[model samples]
Target chain A: MKSKTIKASATATLINELDKALSDGFKPTLAIIFSSIKQDWKAVCNMLDERNIKVFGATTAGEFIDGDIEEGSIVVMLLDMNTAYFKLEFLETSEKTTFEDAKKLGSIGKKTFSNPAFILATGGIFIDGEHVIDGITEGFGSEVTVFGGMAGDDLIAEKPIVFTNNKSKDNAIVALIIDKDKIDVRGIASCGWEAIGTTKTVTKSEGNIVYTIDDKPALDTLMKYLGVEVKLDETQEIVAFLNSWYYPLQLERENGDTVIRATRFANQKERSLICTGSVAQGSKIKFSLPPDFDAIETVVSECKSIKDNPEQQADALIMFSCVSRHLSFGALMQEEIEQVQNIWNAPMVGFFTYGEYGRSKIGNNEFHNNACCVVALKEKA
Target chain B: MNQNLQTILDFIQQSKHLSEDEKATLTKAAKDADKALTISEFKLVRTEKVKRTTAILLEETIEELEHKRKAIEDSNNALQKSLKELKATQSQLIQSEKMASLGELTAGIAHEIQNPLNFVNNFSEVSKELLEEMQEELEEGNLEDVKEIANDVIQNLEKILHHGQRADGIVKGMLMHSRSNSGEKESVDINNLVDEYLRLAYHGLRSKDKSFNAKLETNYDDSIKTVNVVPQDIGRVVLNLITNAFYAVNEKNLLQETQGDKYEPTVSVATNTMKNNIEISVKDNGNGIPQKALDKIFQPFFTTKPTGQGTGLGLSLSYDIVKAHNGELKVETKEGQGTKFIIKIPII
Candidate 1:
């Protein structure tokens, strides 16, 4: 298998780069695009469709290209493989149908591929992403490799767009299924943030809206920890939501793996927290501090361990890095991405997403926020 | 750019192509440069040592602060525990004090009322006997009109005797309420105790509120054998729960009247002998406790009544009494519906 990555700021530039990579008797079987929301997604989809290329992608907060990360640009990874088969599926989801839609996608992939590596992307603003994984895992079981991310809107906090060659959808999940006899897929999800303060139980919650923590209003408890005066009557909803990016709730799963969920929105009138994903009532959660320089090292190290496996040669790499990491690391995020780039020195493409989806070391597949998920696909020789 | 340094640099630059004697001079200058580098390295090491020491001290101080914080937290927890115990003791003392005062007043009233009650009983009996003797004389056909009037007097005396006995029963109940139990266990009839308290509580509330009335009901299992308990303490618990039940129904009744709704206020006391325990339940159809306040109903100083109406210690003290008897007190309630307090004491 062979792959190539290209970065472009405009449609023409993107097409030009694609042309260059598709030259020399190379015909891409699939193209994975991660474009900024500012780019013209319709035009880009039309251009790829004209070339008879199968396309799957979503808009991103920021795109990762070559060895650098850039905003307002598009990154595409085109794969030219010998024996692997690729299938794309899209399912529209809403608050009521997210789980069933995920299950439907899973059942479709199960019937289509014998050995499948599933890649998924969905809108980040609504829908409990955790239950989506639950539904898929229910159908595909724990043995199937599942990895993906929730689509982002460049920190605009609006709806994000996901697309296949046929149509673009706002609240939908787009999946890429890879069935191969000789390709090996592995992934790692890691969050380097440390928990601060004491653990608190979710006292009152319904779905993704948490009304109380430790029997206090969830918003008030969070504000108390942040040392910010809780202004219930004031218009501080936006500030509260923005401030929550630094202190996501870290929930430990029954299997001993931890997943972080950040507050996507705040209800001022109700004084509740709307998380990126659902948290169970009575679940113990801890507020996590922002990642320091050591976190950069930890992520880089995790990437290297996967990339430097002597037994397998990595051919393609895809990353779902949480946008909160960008806010936490600032310019140092570049070095962290570069360090991972140095590991495989291969074709890589990714985007900073609102939430990431991957399996941890000791747990089943999970959806996470404020963490980095790295997927490395290698072709067995 | 010093003269000596410049000469050394120039010799090193020219040393590659120089003779052995010039190379020897270059070697000497190189050794001097090595010495200067060593000196700088030593200075850096010393600076790093100071920084390392300072960092170590800071870490130790942070550790000390953490320890102190934990100590303070533990101390605060201990103090909070002590405060809780103190409050409980205060509540117990207040309840005991209230009972003591009520006992003193009831004892004095009983003493004063018993004297007149005895006289009423004695005089009524004497008057009935004299009326009977007159009826005999009338039967002998002498003073028939006088005999008829004596019959009316005897009937009135009988009425006075019946009412006096009823008042005496009430006085006895009040005296029992004021009596302190010695915590001695005895095989007491649970049915009789519950029945007595039900009437006492109902009449007690009726006396306080002229309009308050409730339909009191009881269902006692005939097969229920007597259980060992401190009769006085158990009686107090029964009375407290029954009184609350009446109060709840009365409140609901008042509300129903204002809402133009007809509701029959009812309070029921039931006893059933289970396989291993005796279950006594006091149920009332009244405005139930709200959900937020339900969990704290048995807590001292928690009450829904208006000020000066309730001490809020009735349920709390009753709870302690039941718990001390190795029994469990449980309540099930629904807002705007009713509440049921169930007490289960082990047969053993």
Candidate 2:
């Protein structure tokens, strides 16, 4: 397989770059696009559709290639692989039907390839990402290779979309199902945040809305307990979790592992915190301080775990990094992304997401928040 | 003698054994690695600051949670104490309701016993006179007069015995109502039970207010043999319903006094054997329960009477007592005409 990456702030400039790359007699079968909602993503799909290339696209908080990251721009990884080895499927769902929808798609992927690996991008504000994981596991009758991210609308936090040619929806999931026999797909989800303080119980919550923790208002308790100050916009609501990203809640799981939960929005009048995923009432949780530089090292090292040695190479890389990392690490996030890209030295395309779906180290596939998920793909034959 | 890599590079640069271009590339590579190391060092320093702040936060949060746990424990202790006090108060209120009903029955019971006692006294006085007459006749050798006097004394003795038993039954019934629940069920005659409460309730009211009078009527169901029930609890219920019926009629009677209407205050109590239960109903031809107060008629502490007249627990307690027997208590009322309370107890 051969791959090339192109990025531009405008759809026309992106098309020009595509034209320049195509003129060199490089024929591509698929285009993986990550872009800001401000860009005309519809035009990019049309251009790719004319070229008979399958498009699996999502709106992003920030889009990046190997060397640099940009806002309000488009990044594309054009791959010239055998069409028989891969299929792109797009599915839409209602508020209460995301699990069933993902299950149906999973079954379809199973039927498409004897041994299929799914690369997914989802779009929904309140969808429990774990349901999708569990549903797919049930539909396929077992767990398989699954890697994806929750779509973001450039920090607007309103309507993130996952689109294909001529179809896009805020409540939908787009999958890239590849036959693992023809292509090797391996990935890792890494979060190296250390938990601080004793665990506190969530006193009251429903779904993603946390009402209280330790019998006090959940929002106030989060601030007071952590001694962290969060800034509010003119409406007295935290804007896009920009200030509180550094102090995410680490959910203590029964298996002795922890998953991160980043507060995405707030209800000041209700005195509640709205999270990217559900925090069950009575579940124990601890506050996490910002990760050190080792966080990047861990991500790169774990990505290398899929390979036999450090010198092993990948044809292409796709990353689903939680947007909280961007807000927390600020400029330091670049070093992490660059390091992960260096491991494979491949043409890479990725976007910072609302949440991520992949497998953490030493676990089954999972839904994660405030973690970086890197997927490396290369043809086996 | 030194074959170290750094030493080799130094010797090459000093002896001019390597090209400047080669030396420049190696130097650039070394500088790039150093620059990467520098970036890592900077991130490490920043992370140390984060650790210090996080340490402080953890200490403060752990302290606060400990304090909250202590306060919650204290609050729980206080709540437990309050609960114990509340239980005591509830039982006291139940007893007070019982004593209040017993007080209402006291006057009626005394008057009822007085009637039987009067009969006994009259019969004894007559018997004494007859005995003196018999003695005078015997002194005159009149056998026929002595025999007639003896027969009269025997008849008086029988009447005295009948009245004495009637007084005893009233006292025993009064005692049953005032006693605490024995938690036992017994077969009791429904007609006799209703009759006893009807008379006791009426006479009690009359003793309290001489001007308050109401006509009483009864229909006893002869077919109702016996019902297995907690006798004291059921007696309390019957007494409460009859008393309420009397109060209703008297209330109407007082209103009628001003209107000068030809209203005859009547309270009718009856017992009947239904399909599988004995139904006792006390009906009053007086003002009924108001529409707004209908729902709350069986709620504790909800009184239709002015303060101190009723305990507001009569119907509520009656409802619970009937429920304990797996029975039903129902009320039917009209706005201005009347109200009828029905109690149905399963006949065993």
Q: TM-score: which candidate is best?
A: 2
Model 1 stretches astray by more than 4 angstroms: A82-84, A228-240, B1-348
Candidate 1 residues B1-348, lDDT tens each? 345666777766676678778777777777677656654554465345434434543464466569779999999999999999998988577557458435433433455456667767777777777777777777877787666767767676776777677677667766555655567888988998788667655655555566877888899998887999887778778877887888899888888899999999999899998889999999999988898998899998788889966778778877988998899999999888999999999887
Report the C-alpha lDDT of model 2 over A148-265, residue by residue, as the tens digit.
9999998877899999888898889999999999999989998887788877889999877789987889888777766665566676654455445678888888788788887877
Off by over 4 Å in 2: A228-240, B1-56, B68-348
Distance from true location, Cα of A237 in model 1, Å: 8.5
Residue B105, model 1, lDDT: 38
Task: Give the clashing residue pairs of candidate 1, or none.
Answer: none
* lDDT per residue as tens, model 1, A27-53: 877789998999987887888889777
Query: Which residue pairs does candidate 2 place in steric collision?
Result: none
The C-alpha TM-scores of every prediction are: 0.54, 0.56
